[model samples]
Target: MSNNSNTALGILAGAAIGALAGILFAPDKGSNTRRKIAEQAAATQESLKENALDLKERVSETVAVQKENLGTRVENLVSDVSYKTEDVITTLEAKLKELKAKNKQLQKS
Candidate 1:
């Protein structure tokens, strides 16, 4: 299996074993043990929720940064192309003017 799947399975197996051990080794009465387990589960769930939210926020910030970087790159590329196009047009215009002047001189001769 993939590394990600293996890691997930390992984590799940560890959690299950830990929970079972906690229940089996508890010194308190059954009712108190059950209550403690419930409280611990609730706390763990809340912690996981907070972690997930933080991960999502980080991912969003990363994407925003990447998008802004891409936009800047695209703008720079477009500006470069525009500048090159203007240079080509100016050169062509100068060439045409020179050719026209040469043609007029040839016609006079």
Candidate 2:
């Protein structure tokens, strides 16, 4: 898991333990204590759901950005290769022209 996930997990765990301890230690009727525990459990469940949704959103966003970056890099590499290929072709053509000229002069002499 990521650092952010670990930190959030740790925080959630700590809050849950703290809340349980506090509610258990309170001087109240058994029914009241049980009700408080149930309420706390429900609240914690909602919090976990929200956190999971938020993390999913962040992961999706990160993946999309990375994909876009990869696409751009690929395009740049292809463009560079195309230009270099053109340059190589041009150089070869010039050399061929030079060789043909020399061959013609020698043939005439």
Candidate 3:
């Protein structure tokens, strides 16, 4: 995008220079040449404004997508941890019951 913008700027600069040179060399009236230059400058300004808006929108969309992806990743990680914790708790409960049963048998003996 940067490269494209640079190329666009270079093209606009060249066009402005070429137009100025042509007007200077022509036999047209001084007022007419100045008017033409102003028109050209206004047109260039509008073009730059449009390009800036487009670049801004693209950046905004990219950020939104990244944010959504990050949310999804965090949710998945939480779910995985929850499942692992449940499994660990279940195993510990089973071991505890077995140990209790063994202790009761020793008391009976």
Q: Between 1 and 3, whose lDDT is larger?
A: 3
Tell me how far the alpha carbon of residue 4 in candidate 1 is from the true structure, in angstroms, after superposition. Answer: 12
Q: For residues 1-109, write the lDDT of model 3, one tens digit per residue.
A: 6798788778877987897788778898989989988887888789878878887898889899999999999999999999999999999999999999999999999
Off by over 4 Å in 3: 17-27
| Strongest candidate by TM-score | 2
**Candidate that beats the other on lDDT, 1 or 2, i.e. the better one:** 2
> Per-residue lDDT for 34 in model 2?
99
With a 3 Å backbone cut-off (N, CA, C), the pairs that clash in candidate 2 are: none
- Per-candidate TM-scores read 0.76, 0.91, 0.76
Which residue pairs does candidate 1 place in steric collision?
none
What tens digits encode model 2's per-residue C-alpha lDDT throughout 4-65?
Answer: 89899899989999999999999999999999999999999999999999999999999999
Please report, as a residue range, the 10-residue window in candidate 2 with the lowest summed lDDT: 1-10
lDDT of 1 by residue, 30-107 (tens): 998888788767766775666566667877898999999999999999999999999999999999999999999999
- Model 1 is weakest, by summed lDDT over 10 consecutive residues, at 1-10
Candidate 1 local Cα displacement, residue 33, angstroms: 1.8
